[model samples]
Target: MFKVRVLNEEVIKQVIDMKQVVGAIEEVYRLKSNEKTEVFDMVFHEFERGVADMDIKSGHLKGEDIFGLKVVSWFKDNEDKKLPMLIGTTMVFDSKTGMPIGMLNAEYITGMRTGAAGAIGAKYLARENSADLLMVGAGHQATFQIAATLISMQNIKNVRIYDPIDSNNAKKLAESMKELLKDKFLSKYENTDLYDEISKKFNVNFEGVDDLEKAVKISDVIITATPSRKPLIKKEWVKKGTHFSCVGSDMNGKQEIDENILACARVYVDDMNQALDVGEIEIGIKNKTISKEDIICEIGDVIVGKEKGRLSEDDITVYDTTGIALQDLMTSKIVLDAAKEKNLGVVVDL
Candidate 1:
């Protein structure tokens, strides 16, 4: 057995820098893959129904160079302590036998995979001419969303960010991203109340519209990464040809888009069974906002060419992203492969 410990920020940064992770995501759509979305509902009660506290424990048991267990915990209220809102670790095992091989932090992997999912969705669903982007909630996930979008959409010229937090942190994050990209991406950060400023900005026109509605109305591509229990993006706000990538609501009762949106849009889920039971799609079904018949395709189906993505430019599309274990497995494989090439991990026999 061998062991490796990847610190939180370092793993997150590694995930940020790994292009293979994005490639893996693109492959996921091609694998005709199915997601096994599971949740320990009892655990939510222990965490106090807090979006930031919902713990996701998962593992990937198949595929070459992909065998690991991961635990993810979200606690957004701990920022005062300089702690990340989401944190967790992963344990990789040797596939030949049931032996442990290494360990790594999973928080970063989760964000990257979620963001990559958005990018993949945009690649298939967003208009080819889509240029402007609107992002709701500027956090770790938001950063990855920007990264993925920049990589996937070559024409994206401007990105508008809206968050309720103070302007200092938002500006700092934006600046850091700008510097990291060497000014290849242009981002505008605003401290305006989401509801109040929605109408003024064409990219984020929320005026005369509620938060959820306004967010859906202004942009060709809308990415919502909040931890809200109730709906944040409504159906009425979404127009024809709009593409939505929702990453915030992964657990039961946690939803970011209105149920009505699911009813009308060409909805695609990372995993259908998982979405039907615990993902946002499940919540919509339980509330009767959408029927099981409303589902259009799974990410894999679209990737494999088995199902159609956006048939026309006027279609409304939504991709509900419930973080998947295979994502971490693939990302870890990429990192571990790079580490092996660069002699990055300390190897020991146990």
Candidate 2:
């Protein structure tokens, strides 16, 4: 007597829009800050081969119509095998009766929602005049971070990108971004100076940079989205009034920035429970550089007025995100609704 809609990555892409995601994730943060949601703790499992790992993140929406669960995997050999690094799905159900309503490909959703969270974090925590952005990764997640930041912040002048393993990865990111961004502005320039002309016309420049120190030193807001066991960004290179959004440390013992950065920076997290356990904040706490109490507040609390985000323009702020479940759940609600409205997925009787 019922049916469920199934969506794949291609179908999900048809409905993927950055502006909608940013707005939806922000709305969920308010709901969470007011104590109207339940985001469960994440569970991790390692395959026997020891080269692959899976993460399970689930959550419920109070007084809403849907809940979601996201299961994702990271395999070390994926690139070697010519496979996708991120493979996951989102399972959505009716909140009232516990009936399944939809299932969707989650790779894009996970990256997009995480990107939106960082952009929202920047909106409240970064200096108003923040323009230059330094993205320390050139993979799939880094692209989302750049695209979403450009949407959230206006008058941005420069974006500097770096990747450790593949220098070409950064160059490819710049070209892809140019294609994605060309439609946002009107262009009348020659082929030789197309990139510079586009930047001059839009007053924004995004490109790949080889010097990591120079990138960090000149940036107003820095976003780290790489999976690195060692610290990549140093505290000394970070300028005053800079904001850093650490998005890659979703697993235990993974770090992306120098712990000393958190010692001096006014730190914020998506959720204290998760951030203290696995996020970049966990590194600072483990090293005794800073304690949980040292964290200024959760980004959600800043949205609901329970705590302030950044007190001064000169304040150094760091937001450590562990990929909240509520973000996945709420974002899926929006994606599923849009898919249904557009008739974009396959429906089957259950």
Tens digit of per-residue lDDT, candidate 2, span 1-350: 56899988777766767777888888888887888888876788888456888988888888466777889888878999999867988888898888998888887788789889878877888888888988888977886787677777755778888886787888788766776555422232335444464344344666888888888998899999888988998888988999999998987789999999899999999888999888988878988999888998888899889999888888999989888777877778787888899988899888
Candidate 2 regions with alpha-carbon error over 4 angstroms: 77-82, 182-203
* lDDT (10s digit) by residue, model 1, range 1-350: 45553434453453245244567877655553534322223233246554456544555534453466676666757787798766777776666676766676776677677888887878777888776677777766777787676666646656766554544545565556555443222222224342223212222212111243454566788887876777766666777888888788776678877788777788998877667767778788987888888888788788777888888888888888776666776666676666666665566665
The per-prediction CA RMSD against the true structure, in angstroms, equals: 7.5, 4.6
Candidate 1: clashing pairs of residues = 52-74, 198-205, 198-206, 198-207, 199-206, 199-207
Query: lDDT score of model 1?
Result: 0.65
TM-score of 1: 0.79
Give Cα distance to truth, residue 89, candidate 2, Å: 1.3
What TM-score against the true fold does each predicted structure earn? Answer: 0.79, 0.91
lDDT for each candidate structure: 0.65, 0.81
lDDT (0-100) at residue 104 of candidate 2?
82
State model 2's lDDT: 0.81
Best TM-score among the predictions, by candidate number: 2
